[model samples]
Target: MAGSAFFMACAILVLFGFCVEAELVQHTFKVSNMMVRRYCKNKTITVVNGEYPGPTITAHEGDSLAIQVINESPYNISIHWHGIFQRMTPWADGPNYITQCPITPGNSYTYKFNVVGQEGTLWWHAHVSVLRATVYGALIILPRAGVVGYPFPNPHKEETILLGEWWKADVITLQNRALASGSAFNISDAYTINGHLGDLYRCSNKHTHKLEVEQGKSYLLRIINAALNTQFFFKIAGHRLTVVAADASYTSPFSTDTIAIAPGPTIDALLHADSHPSNYYISALTYASSPAIPFDKAASPYASAPPSASPFDNTTTVAVLSYKSSPPSSSPPIMPPLPAFNDTPTAHHFYSNLTALHPNSVPLQIDQRMFVAFGLGLTPCSVNQPLCRGNAISASMNNISFSFPTTVSMLEAHFRKIRGVYTKDFPNRPLVAFDFSNPSVNNQGSFQLTDKGTKVKKLKYNETVEVVLQNTAVLAAENHPLHLHGYNFYVVAQGFGNYNKKEARKNYNLVNPQERNTIAVPVGGWAVIRFRADNPGLWIMHCHLDGHLSLGLAMVFEVGNGPTPSTTVPPPPQDYPTC
Candidate 1:
């Protein structure tokens, strides 16, 4: 990865033209199985370097990283740097079958790329299967060498908090069983803070994660949601959090009692330890937006009948925010009151209120306009099929469930001009246009079925694209966190009900809309984003919810090479994993 660059002091860094040359950081990850006891149950699960939420990788912006991963576990694996802009190095952008084939057991592959012009918090995770339930860690990028400080007031201390989900059964087996039986995967047994299931759960008191704070000092909390299938609401007992950045992009500072984050995005918030010295609860719980669905209680010990209508892991995970020099008291720590599990208003408020700290030039002219209706659907099952005895659950964009090619990676095929791997006929609009958000539309039989194929949309170099993501209510409408590889986009507008071009244009926040690599599309609603397609490569856009991703809510963007050698994507490296 080679390029020229300009550092930003008071400017928004665009993905195409800037690249800074800096340090070369390296790490070797050993993947293997480890036995861990949690909630009185012992289970052997895969881990990286024998650590649960593997080692954090820290580097300055504009640094190059060469991470060698040796897969010693029984399962094949690949690691994805969630929000890094892999400039001219799409082969290093890890995604099983999309960027490269998975490294098999006993095999090793080195991911080499440069982190150009990105700062603040992001993360890395397994891309092969549900293995990310345990194999993940944070990737923090600080400001470049000459930059004075953060865009906001610098905090006295920094902490990394990873929120995760846990299950007693092997996550791979659980997902395979659910797919084979045409049912939903079992709900998680419990949630974790820094990979510890705090004192709220059975047999977990001694291992609760604790953070000590001093009076009159502020701390920067780099919060990453690594949960496979749920969004979380994080709050402290009696403190306000000032959020400064998200998804490695800077945002205007704002104060909130609770922070709502879906999986695959990072939130950098400032916490002031101004309260009187005492023990405060740092808590997180599920914000399940999906409507009520049937849940099998036999699958998990923590599973119970929903006290209300919606089916969710209606449980809380807690950690202690202890004040230094405070006397130990017998009384319990003070807990914060969280929002309801289906509080869409609160989630929307937190998500939409954010604006970019430094405004960029949002493309005023659009070269490509797309309206993608995405959510869950179904496909008819074969009569003699051993798996999926009934209609198999499926998810899609524009009624097309994305199918992965087996023999070669999508990027490889695109680079080599290999035919028969995928078609460049992905629709700009859905094949069948109907009332997307109408609840009654779910009753239509044909509307619930979708076709599966490896179809991609083609884009010319440097084309500006605008996409309107509309969430559907076929099976159930929920908040789907849509993530795009290789670039960040401006979220211009979002609203409930159907998307009207004329009505939405009035509210487009083109001046300072939030810039993020991932955007949580409103539940049963719509969101619009715009970006310039300058990086020429095969990039995938998909839902961050692991279950929905496996069910096929994904699509690829095939960007053509630029006219000049400098702008074109380079060929793959020698050690690129082959199928």
Candidate 2:
């Protein structure tokens, strides 16, 4: 009997090897213009695979996937494989201005890379600035052989839900207007579930996407928050969701009735469908606060009125989480009791223990510290200045707008070196000073632009470093989603208001506090991160908000001295952008 069992095990191992060798798959997709009249209005918008929040591309671990992204739009475009480890695979990183030139209109580029890591929730999106607002989709990686379905029991069905923001106006025009006026330029009227804003308007009915699930069975729901600028709270009326993964990595499973997810974050949950058949709404609501308004105690003839209340109050339904009808004429499905936010003891303990296990893993360190200030206010222009002939309302980073360098050949070329025409006479300290809690500030603040913003702080190949990002309360009271390229970092510490230099030095989590590619700098707060500078390449560290980055809230870092000369790759091939 033991001999027979050994023979059966050997046969199973042979079959698995054969499957691994033969199961690799490759697919090519196109990014082109499609007529998607979202919200029932006959409007046209850019899309991937002729759909908003394009099709989900799935692959197993150890598989090589090739995607041929053809750009048929009237503008330049590029697709980034978000949250993937593209260390040596620079070509597939998809930074249009960095790794390669953009795929111009009527042009095509093939992105090929091996999926060499563990499997979890991943995604792809346009990485060329504003293009991501409209073009994004899910990239799911299934587990390798012999691994069980997930930490929890296998579900009856699985679904991929992507949340996106919709804009009816032209994206370029909307951006330009915001730049010129220096105010909120929200054109979106409704949030989208799988690309459709359901039942909000007459055209909403046409593009609705629905999920049909079975009653009394478990289901796996992979949720991706792909919205451009909104953080959301999600909950289903009749089911409890056990969150098992975050940011494409598995965490210890924690059950909750509601989950808060920020942009660029992904969460996977297991939902046990109700035994009795009943329809219920699966809702996602924005957690954004209203923009602050300047108060006027005395009313005048020309005083402006306050902005009206937003339509997205608590009662709005984001999506329906309905169970299929069953026999026996059942009553309403039972709802699980909600968990308190502070009661996330399992998550806290898991993250804390993980950090203890990996204590010496620091990624990026402070060879030199630079202070940057961001804020919005009215300021008088320099005499006969092109942009400031009068007092103009504006927003700035380090108190300066992004002026394209006239002498540079291109942004990518200029970013390759630490010292250049762009780095001349860099400032030693922040460019603005104001109260973060206050909505407005005085106009006498100083602003300057320097080449240091593009400079590279040198790192030995595979050296560990810790960076403390101090928020000095110099801008509006708002959280900034800080994103880094080339390497993911462990968030060692975070706190409200200015960073306590003494306290942070003693209690830093150098091991593990959730390694991530992007982190949130809290409103009126600071965050410290650690990363290993092992990947040799030019990388960007910037705010994820496209508008803020366009204004000047961005910088580049060049990690040099790799093992191979090919690490410093040449320029992209000619005819790169055919459009």
Candidate 3:
């Protein structure tokens, strides 16, 4: 670990996307309690720097950042820089008990890392328990100062649109109740745009987030879906979005009336304000792919003007996109046509259509291949188990329910040779193969139960690996957004139904497939991703839905050290949190 003097003195000249001198940036986040009112209810929630959506962190490519988090709040917490390739600083890759223990209440920890290689929008959020419901903020990286221009024409300006969820009850309390009962958590009260609940709810029309734009000028919208579990369809009334990036990686620009964004990825789109100088509604609503789960009959009456169609936050959060020439009008703004809640085809088309902006040599040969079958499941209950009123609801991958270590972080255990914290015996494929995509198979005794343990898979450093993720229909069929912590992988192909090894290989897009840190496996379907295990550390891969993740839908990959020092993970920071 470097001292404050060295941190301030160390500077270097480098060329990555541009030539410039790299410097260290610093920020402080004080996690404290704040009282907020929404949907006619007042509640105290945990927040950073007392901001509802938290504070944004901005950096140029090649720059380093040192963010000190002061945990004044009553809960232990840690922050994860989503989509960042932590490089050699895996100790700073925050996921409670995975990378390091959470910073206890009144304690503090500084996250030091470098932003390199990638430039665009990413985000940071609490990775402990369920605090991410409110503890999230945007992380934006720009091209190095000396860069000439972006891949596409630079927009006249840029704006950050953070789509999120809001609840009337205390988030921690809500989660505890759900866990204690071994039942699904109650859905959110409403969805929000930049923390505003919009016109659909009471006392929100005046507080709705509004964006003013100039006619004929294009604006780069750095949109992030910070929702805990829901995927959203975002659109503006009379405007076309030219998507240029996903998960901070540039993509071939594609025009669309709407964008389908899952929980963990950030999207960059160019919005042209060419319509008549009038007010238009920019709306975001749940795109629920799980048709099997029934709708929430108790959904808040303030959710929307019309009833909700899905079980998840069946609400639309709105913002006004107004041209500079127009003022607030009494007439209602036009609403964009949103697909049905279970419009799987629309979601599929949006994901498969994206390709890399610049093609790179996608690995044609694989050194390792693995098939992972994952979904929700149930564990039979004993009369002694109080939490399991009937049967404990759970989820798993390859029939193994991931259990986290309580004494030390997984990375620490691997780094210091600590034993018994976890076992490197995670299965690469299902123990017993069956019809994974068939709804009827969910009734079978073999397919519905899962075993729990802290199991992981080991991989050789620098080995090219391919993983086929197949979503099962054990409990319900829903789109599972799986996020990998350490590296971005190429989403080569995706399709509905079981993945046929022989037939799926033929449809692989080896040339220009989209690269993403998070991929949403289609509901009752499968997707293929390929990447090289270059970074050394314990990297976690899990469903982005917090509920599913809590239910044990996750696993870890232990990538061993590489040949050279530059490719190896360094010693832990002196201030690394201890369990």
Candidate 2, 535: how far from true, in Å? 1.3
Off by over 4 Å in 1: 1-21, 293-310, 382-385
lDDT of each: 0.88, 0.59, 0.87
Per-residue C-alpha lDDT of model 3 across residues 1-579, encoded as one tens digit per residue: 468655444432233332367779899999988998888777888899999899999998889999999999999999999999999999989999999999999899999999988899999999998999999999999988775468998899999999999888787888877677666766898999988889887878776999999989999999999999889999999999999999999999999997999999999999999998888899998888876633232441111111112256678889988899877678988788877877888888898899999886688889988999999876655343466555666889999988888899999999999999999899879999999988766555567778988999999998999999999977677899999999999999999899998999899999899999999999999999999999999999999988889889999999999999998888999999999
**Residue pairs in collision within model 3:** none
Q: Which candidate should be chosen as best, given lDDT against the real structure? A: 1
- In model 1, what lDDT does residue 498 have? 90
| Model 2 per-residue lDDT tens digits across residues 124-182 | 88877577777899999887654335656778888898887777777767766655544
Query: What's the distance in Å from true for residue 459, model 2?
Result: 3.9
* Residue 50 shift from truth in candidate 2, angstroms: 1.3
TM-score of 3: 0.94
- Which run of 10 residues does model 3 get worst, by summed lDDT? 300-309
TM-score of each: 0.93, 0.78, 0.94
Deviation from truth (RMSD, Å), model 1: 5.3
Candidate 3's displacement at residue 266, Å, is 0.8
lDDT of 2 at 466: 68
RMSD of each: 5.3, 5.9, 6.3
When sorted by TM-score, best at the front, the candidate numbers are 3, 1, 2
